[model samples]
Target chain A: MLALELGPVKGSAVLPTSSASGENAFRALFAAHYPFIWRQMRRLGVPESAVDDATQEVFIVAARRMSDIQPGAERSFLFGVARRVAADARRTRHARASAVSEPLGADTADEREDPEQALQGRRSQAMLHRVLDAMADDTREAFVLFELEELSRREIAELLGIPEGTAASRLRRAREEFMEIAGRMKATASRGAP
Target chain B: MKRLKDELPEESFEASLLAADAGGEPPEGPRRRALDAALRVVALGGGSALVAGKAAAAATAGAAATGGGGAAGATGAALAGWKILAVVAIVGGAAVGGAVAVTRTTDVAPSESATSSPSAPVPLARPEPAPPDTQSAAPPPMLAAPAPAPIHVDTPKVAVPSVPSTVPSSAPVFDLAGEVRAIDRARAALAGRDTGETLAALDDYDRRYPAGSLAREAAVLRVEALALRGDHAEAARRAQELLAASPEGPYRARLRKVIDGAAASSP
Candidate 1:
């Protein structure tokens, strides 16, 4: 249940035609979407180590189907491919380990006098990931697109092929769940428990 | 902690944390590697051999295809070796006479030899961005052909007609891809120290693209081939002619290297 951020492609709308134009257009597409795809793959539950491979897998699929993708729909097309790639990687990792190890745990209490200072940067990110990992896949996906990526509700609905109202409801549920869990975590950190 | 009050919206409450989470750009190393891999796979006609650790090979092949970035010493050498076969592919497909076909042949052929063979006898000699002087360089004296027909790569009427094999005799439309392949072959042949073959390839390029856009690249390769072939006097003369034309040309550094090499190697 990873999140996707499928921002609209900007400027160029050059579709693949001849080999030269096709290759050049592909380069433009790659430059525009590489970062978004990389972050999306990470949030989609792909482990850090396998993120590069998963990202490459998504583009490889894109390259093969470049001619078939409609010009304005490239972003959504790539997100769909990224979603499938993340799922495959997650399944593979799940099979390899009896219990999937959480990448960064937020349970360790900081020795620093200021608890808020301890959770500012990397720890904050880790806590976010933990909360994301705890939620149901669908809710997390909607939450991620809206809350983290700042993609509009309409975009998320189009990306997920769901009605706009459905996307809104899902985001609401995800927000409440996120707040409840984050509150509990904040309380635990303040208590200074190991 | 007050930021997370019961009434506060989740978006506003976590704005700081979300910014921390998503603010950074993706790591350049993985982005580069992933791009290199995608370019290689595409060049390979979407082959699934996308091996994880083959970044080095993919990087060279990627650079070659896109004409972007510099290849490392070893990869540059390998690219040089493949240049010979790349030229041969061009010569074989010479009758096709369009940039699209030439690009396809050049990219696919060189990539095949990209991995197993990693070095060649000749050193660096790549086509740089065409300077204004080079871009407007006159057609070669040897070409009896009329001025090149203007390429309409985007025109629906002439945009890669189905039968590429029949198009050349009527009108030779040279584009960047064809020019690149021609230069790559000449450069490769010269790198392999087969100056004779290099000159032959250049001659073919001249004939095919009399008013070629990459005349400057061809000129540079021709001079280098002559210098490497022990034709120091002719090489020096041609290099001087090029230098005199555009003293501040993009190929100035490369031409100086050629002159220095010619001077050092002459008896």
Candidate 2:
């Protein structure tokens, strides 16, 4: 069997030895935080399809700089890597968009429904989706990390490489924008009613 | 609004997150290709370096011997010894390297065969007719003088039948080395206590062989590997996934043990 023989290094516990052992320890740490790192990438707006490759790239960086990462801060380190990867992807997308002609929105058509309750549910979901879509990127990220992912503000700040206050402010802005969009959606629905 | 949130379901979000993170079953092609490429490069570089180093030393010794004619014979013998040492080193290194490469290639094991034989046919007995009433059948001819005592023989020449070679073998004929390698990698991940590598390796195995018999054991090991790496929640979730998928799987007991262990160890 062609196994990745880890010559002599042992467990996931961090050793006080040279950087080589530290790298192994960090590789171990990176494995533990993989899900979170990937989640951060997705929540930060990297498409689901691209998240794995981006996540792999993130870990490659992590692996390369494994020795430099501080103990107990591995989570932050991974989140930071995820944030950068997400930004890079967004930038690439933006560059492509600039180069190519604008394309029609390709959102899938809503499934056919006739019942009033089902219609109302669809309307609600649509309203929420629109509200989420309209928010600024940073605000959306903060809100998702905080409300959806249930990460603490401190963690969010660390992940975004911003101050804790900024994270809180972003969340507040995101919530307000969501409320406004929802209000508009509700007004439009009422106006359309018999 | 409350109903809408309830209908959306927290579990759905969790599922989406997991799906998003899982990306898909890993790309086996790329990983294997990359590993192969790396090994090739290493082998080539090592080979070149060995050759170059030997050539350089040989040239230096040759020059030294040429500059000292008085000690030429002794130098020539020493040079021959150096050449032998160099050849030994290069040959030994290459052999070891080849062995390592072969050991690294994960492949399948061989299978076994089957067949068996038949027995003799039995003679059926015919029904005897009732004694004729008309003429007493000439009194049965007095048994015809006992039929010459029926020349008895000692042993019957029974035909020992050979087994037919047409049946298919039921033995599994896949790469045991690959499975063992995968298990070893998982074990290494577990030893590192890295939840990520362990989960990734498990996921890789599962993706590559969804219906593999050893999948359940790998899943159980994944849970342990994750837990050892200090990711209790993910370990618990994975355990739940395993239990839900195959409650009666071979590794169910081990899965439960890992789950219990994780729970106990969780903060």
Which candidate has the highest lDDT of all? 1
Give candidate 2's whole-model lDDT: 0.39
**DockQ for each candidate?**
0.06, 0.01
**How well does candidate 2 score on lDDT at residue A86?**
67
Comparing only chain A of model 2 with the true chain A, what is the TM-score? 0.65
- CA lDDT of each prediction against the hidden true structure: 0.49, 0.39
* Highest-scoring model, DockQ: 1
| lDDT (10s digit) by residue, model 1, range B1-267 | 111223455444255445556534777765665565454323322211112123224423333422322232334344332211000011111111111111111222322332212111111111224432532232111100000111211224322222212113322321223444465556556545577888998998888776664576678768767766677778878998898887755455556665776677677
**Which regions of candidate 1 fall more than 4 Å away from where they truly are?**
A1-17, A93-115, A191-194, B1-16, B46-267
The regions of model 2 sitting more than 4 angstroms off are: A1-23, A97-134, A161-163, A181-194, B1-267
TM-score of 2: 0.35
Tens-place lDDT per residue, model 2, B157-230, is 21111211111121111222233235435544554445588678778776655544234446556666665566
Q: What is the lDDT, from 0 to 100, of the residue A136 in candidate 1?
A: 76
What are the per-residue Cα lDDT tens digits for candidate 1 across A60-163?
Answer: 55654443232334455577777766665666566655475533233445453234664566667766766776677788778777776666676676556567
